[model samples]
Target: MVMGGKSALQQSAERHLWMNFSQLGYYARGKKLPVMVRGEGCYVWDEHGKRYLDGLSSLFCVNIGHGRADVAQAGADQGKQLEYFPTWSAAHPPAIRLAERIASLAPGDLNRVFFTSGGSESVDSAIKLARQYHRVTGNALKTKIIARDIAYHGTTMGALALTGIDSIKEPFAPLLPGGIHVPNTSVYRLPPDRTADSLAEAVKRRIEIEGPDTVAAVILEPVQTAGGCYMPPPGYFARVREICDEHNVLMISDEVICAWGRLGEWFGCERFGYIPDIITTAKGLTSAYAPMGAVIARDAVAEPFLNGDTSFLHGFTFAGHPMSAAIALANIDVFEREDLLDHVRHNQDGFRAMLESLRDIPIVGDVRGTGYFHAVELVRDQDTKEPFSPEDQVSLLGYLSDELQERGLIFRADDRGGPVVQLAPPLIAGPAQFNEMEELLRPVLHKASELFPHAR
Candidate 1:
């Protein structure tokens, strides 16, 4: 069937496309959905031909920007050479080369790569690897995973168990067991009596409470993404690393969104000055040009599985597809060629300042995060840092979310931790794109402040 115009597209989408994490009822009720048709540089054009600045980098995955014909062509060329191949029992050239490349770039001794289809699978794979690593080393009871509160890991059963958000996990009761929650390093919301080190110490306390022998790994993002780009307090990771080492627990850096220049480094852990026993990454690995994810294990972590006839005992069919691997190689090439990491490092301060300028707004409570990733928290009382009621949060975020998009800006208007606007522009975005974001944000947010006056 030949696809028609926007109406037909919307109709088909409403009929067939069950979008992930979207309220299908809205589209079903005939609300006009923005159908993005094309993307280039730091912008994307909807089906109506209106262009919007991609402030969230297309869900924080499109790091090198979009519409790179060269990268797309690389996949096409590889498809022509070898359309598909599996990484189980046998290996292919693209997978082999990409693994070697990733191993070289990963920090410390994280040199072994196990490929998966996306972030959720990578996380699930890490969970399994951590458990198996303990079991093989004669400690079979170590199966629990300790993760931060309100952190979004992934949607798979194992990954969902690892996720800390309560609302999303409630519906899927009886999830994989042995998943424990710890406090995240959200310093903005830190109590007056508590220091940042206390957050790190919470991990130690949780480990002691749970018994070290029962905990297999402690997974964390360098900069927690879901709870409004929560940055790790100073010495947080260093302390966590020490705690994990002392307890013989594996440290897994879940860099699904933080890696590949999102935080001005090849890996987010590098930005925080720590190494992990395993690193589960995806999204920007191929700049989301193709579906791919990997669990990078430290040399020691891989040792138990390598001995004699022991194997990982787990695999995904399309984990290391040739074309996806080729696209990832090409994506890495784009990163190096454009010096995207250096680009983010050079301009991160400017980006932060732009967001910081909004703090004067009556509702703007705090501005936080690092590199291209940042967020502006909305509040009902600036002086008290009082958050909006659930009803008000829905109203405020809904208005701001719609207004921002209608005004040609694409970013995240979230209420995960609180009412916050998350911004993570493409690495290629500079002052010009920053100004575009500010231009779009200033008027809309100011209006929101006026319209949704703080209830005294």
Candidate 2:
């Protein structure tokens, strides 16, 4: 019953589901967890009904796939009209019409939207609104925070001290301090004569050795998704927005998994033209059904809390939850009635030519990413690019994540920084879900390059 029939409330959710970031001692030893239940356009069906192919959208945040009955009837008519409220200091009407429709779909002059309850409280409320908008505009020694190397940017405690993945912040050791880190646009793992203007002058030499009025923000991620889908190079975020506008620093774009429409713009620094001063989104706004997130800023960083009493004193008790802002204004009305950011910018070049035709297999060394957020990268020496020897990256990412979820093709077989696989799918994923994800990723990456074999 638990496997296929899966009833009895799905076997009581493996005894009281504590699931975030899994491995709960393999579901407290019994090991069932694979539930899933249902979904539709773009598939999902587990609890043994099997099916799949939500690919990474379930994590990358559903963009507008999976049985979206008009975003669950606009969160069931805002839970029968205002199910909950609290943008604290009172505000409703679906969080003031979804914060005036995410400040008219965010971009330059971002127009202040706050809210949070996901993407690590919109990256710890845009690093406490960039250190209280530089201490109410007089730069009380800014307050440090750059990010890149293996960048993840979430988990809590000031976005886990701006998380750059030192083994997931080394067992959460004394975090939430200034938290700096760098070098990540990953010219396939840097080093060889580093470029991208020396990684944007290593963020202007780590904000001139953390002395540009004690640097208050830099946080990136136009792509760098969990540090593998990496991207950003060509004039890297226009040289980190000219090194945070010649060091007045406050870039902060985080876009929690590259904003809505996954990567075919609608943010992701407007497909790398660059315009930061804080963005921090959530997994495709309300595409994750309801839980929401935001931050947005830039009316010159909310003009020192728009004058008067000076209040940016952070918030969240389900920040802006009028049924997650009426399921984020009915998920931006299904992303403007299924334009889904121009259908992932007209099928992201056939999903980057079907992940660059898996670069002639042999451990698909580096396909990289752009839209529909790619990855691939596996190498053992695709002519000496040579990665994957952390015990063959946990036995070729646990055998291509259990043979591509037993051949139904759900993605993300990550290794945090190295071995890859990721994919984004579901912005109404096309070309027949990229030919059923390259026919379930080419024979499971051709049997994971023959059980992780490579070099001559």
In lDDT terms, which candidate is top?
1
lDDT of 1 by residue, 356-435 (tens): 99877889999999999999999988888999889989999999988998999999987888899999999999999988
Q: Give per-residue CA lDDT, model 2, range 1-456, as digits (tens).
A: 435544656467656867677776765565445678899988899866889888788888888888888778877887887688677778878888888788888887888788888888888888888888898888988989888777888888888887887887788789878989988887877787786668878889988987999999889888888757878778888878887898888888888778887888778888878788889888788878877888888888888787788998878788888887888788888888878888888888998898888788877878888778888888887877878779978888888887788778888877887788888887888898898899988888887788777875
What TM-score goes with each of the models?
0.98, 0.39
Q: Clashing pairs in model 1?
A: none
Alpha-carbon local distance difference test for all models = 0.93, 0.82
Model 2 alpha-carbon miss at residue 356, Å: 20
Model 2 lDDT-worst window of ten: 1-10
